[model samples]
Target chain A: MAMVLYELCGIDEELRFSPYCWRVRYALAHKGLTAETRPWYFTDKEALAFSGSDKVPVLVDGDQAIADSYEILRYLDRSYPEAPLLGDGMAESRARFFKHYAERSLAPAMLRTIIMDLLNAIHPKDRDYFRETREKRFGRALEEFHSPAKGLAQLDAALEPLRGQLKESDFIDGAAPAAADYLVFGSFMWARVVSSADLVSNADPVYGWLERMLDLHDGLGRSAMRVTDVEGAYR
Target chain B: MAMVLYELCGIDEELRFSPYCWRVRYALAHKGLTAETRPWYFTDKEALAFSGSDKVPVLVDGDQAIADSYEILRYLDRSYPEAPLLGDGMAESRARFFKHYAERSLAPAMLRTIIMDLLNAIHPKDRDYFRETREKRFGRALEEFHSPAKGLAQLDAALEPLRGQLKESDFIDGAAPAAADYLVFGSFMWARVVSSADLVSNADPVYGWLERMLDLHDGLGRSAMRVTDVEGAYR
Candidate 1:
């Protein structure tokens, strides 16, 4: 009955808990799924191997080896359909439309920004740890992190669609949180963590909705998990 | 009750009856959904607007507007769960896993090659018509397609996990076609229509899969009406 979410517990300052991982964390909590946390530093190669990817926020659910936050979210929804991630009726379709946009378009921008600032933004103490670890897996110098311009462009393109949605509703779909909210939360959380809070801070309903989500996190004490040591474990 | 599928009938030299579109096409046929065809040219501006984006292979089921091929497929599965796009148990999971890979990874490379030769590859008679239409929607010169390097790299990166699947199984899963087959079929068909015949012919399992999917399309010809145009009637 226990699932383990293996993650990196903050190895650096800029190495915040990945929004990709955070989505799954929220899902497990939402579904009330009993999950054990496996925290690791960037040095922990063993955890990455068994998880099938070096990426954190991997869900080990019994015999199922699920990677990718979206996949993990899907697995959670199917396994526990009572609460329902997409929500009810027409909302399901609307939620999915925005969630797809968030994951496919928006999150990539936030992630790129985080990676681009690896040396300066990341905690100096853990910089070597992250560089050494990622080098082992990606076989590239962290220095060659791709330009953030393309990522930002895609993000802005994605947000163009949402501009109308926020104008109409308090949430991406309507009044309630759906998968889009959570998906965006993960990325926006990254923005929040890295001091790049302007991305959604004043953006209408998203701003208010994000505050509500932060409240939920505070209520649950889930946000207590720091971004430095066990950060990759949650990534 | 007959479910009318709104479709365009003409050849989309760029995207054509790609597996992505055909996935919907076949699903409509399989579910016994009565859909009308609305054949369109790739450059048709109004058609893209009606479809919610400048993309083809959109299916209009009454008022429900489903865009992404993945989202459309999922909608079909939910709306018509009796026959089931995904079969039972492990069969379904394995099928879904392949599809996730196809949509996320395989399609981009196919897009890269196809977009490269678009001008020369589209039907010569429709050349002017095609450019004008595409320009109206995408707002870019047809010749200045930027670069295929990024898309190619993404496609290759996405294919890494898929290469493992191909090595293990023939159909990207097994003997029968899964959703992955349908998802990937769209990209492959696009490649077949837009890439040099010689180039598409040389693309390995992608090339090989195209031949097999042709058989599936052939099957459609006998039982279902071949749609030729997308019209406002479906709206």
Candidate 2:
């Protein structure tokens, strides 16, 4: 029997554009599993009660409920090991390294950049909802994210090590798509999708690699919407 | 033939006892695999270089150099499936859930608590080395950890969810010792070994549970730290 997954979409604006979610989406598609995504507004209380957490990208598979992104990824990997994400030997090691980097290092910095310009982009009514949800998790106002300069600088500095590696290989580990490639693939794709160009500015190899990465997936973003509500009817 | 693992260990104050390292140690013991531990201090830069990062509890088996703690656990689980971490279906799922919680949620707050308290307890002379090393990863001064109140509060709050569960079940999952037990087990054990009764406070079920857990393998904090270093020597 196929597992049923419910993803709370629309809460994280750039989440569809998020490398974390993109990894799950790609894995699901790669494994040929079907899932139901419900477009969620952060202001709505109904979603949280049903999901058990306000976090977007909450996955529900039968009786199982997982919140953290990596846990969900591992669950899928174990459940379906045919088209394995870990590949073989060294490839497995490399995949894990990149995934960890993306989650721990890349995502935090990307969040800083997105928050800096959130108000300018989001619909006025949704801004309050975004702030409230974020404050619940982060324990501060959205104003804290206003000055993303420090975060951006830190992120750029962190990328120095990776940029050095890009000078030689097109991918982080070796040739072809390893675990690291999926990360680079997911991150760059989401950044491009959400219009976060500053994430991958002009640099020797990283910028060039980003362009090449998008080409592999034919340049389309990774997620499809699962729920829509119109005219007082939820579908 | 047993798998050959290149391991980094020792120099008491260095690496300052990471939970990530303990995870691998228990997993190794669980698998009955003996790995050679090479003790390295902060002054010893050569060993750190091969690790690809300045992190300990690193395992180099053949050509693979893995960094993340969770990934290392998975590698151990896959490579040595003899004394299986994930037993049967229900047990496997339960183990995965508990282990995931330990690795993802509990460890972070536990780390914050340990790092904060350890900074305060260590001698003045060693403080500089400790602060400098930790600052590199955590991005702040040990002084920031001077106020462990906030860190402890967070840890308490994070652990609140497990209160009900621990009261009912001896282990995080059900009756048996599973992977989750190892994950949580390692953290508490580290705390117990380094600074006993400081980070974790005693309160009925949780406190009683900790004592019961310690008794699992004859009261030694983990299958007898198989790769032990004696007198600044790499064994």
Best by the TM-score measure:
1
- Chain A fold similarity by TM-score, each prediction: 0.68, 0.68
Per-residue lDDT for A1-235 in model 1, tens only? 6898875545442244566767776777667776887765555667678767767778888888788786787788777886666543333323333344455556656555556443444545557876786668656765555446655554554454345445555654345544666766776765555533355536554566666677764443235434433444333
Q: For residues B93-201, could you state the per-residue lDDT of candidate 1 as single tens digits?
A: 2344334445544554445445545555444455787678766755787555435666565555444434333433455434544465565565555454444334332
* Local accuracy of candidate 2 as per-residue lDDT tens digits, A118-231: 443333456677677787877777677644686666467445546655664665544443345565466554444444437667855678776665555444342332112112
After superposition, the stretches of candidate 1 with alpha carbons farther than 4 Å from their true spots are: A1-7, A11-21, A33-40, A43-112, A116-127, A137-140, A150-235, B1-23, B32-81, B85-128, B146-184, B197-235
Give me the runs in candidate 2 sitting further than 4 Å from their true place: A1-24, A32-112, A123-141, A149-192, A195-216, A221-235, B1-25, B32-81, B85-191, B200-215, B222-235
* TM-scores of all candidate predictions against the true structure: 0.53, 0.44
lDDT of 2 by residue, B133-183 (tens): 878877777566444566566556445435545665666545655465676
- Cα-based lDDT for every prediction: 0.55, 0.55
Residue B7 displacement in candidate 2 (angstroms): 12
For each candidate in turn, the interface RMSD (Å) is 12.2, 13.6
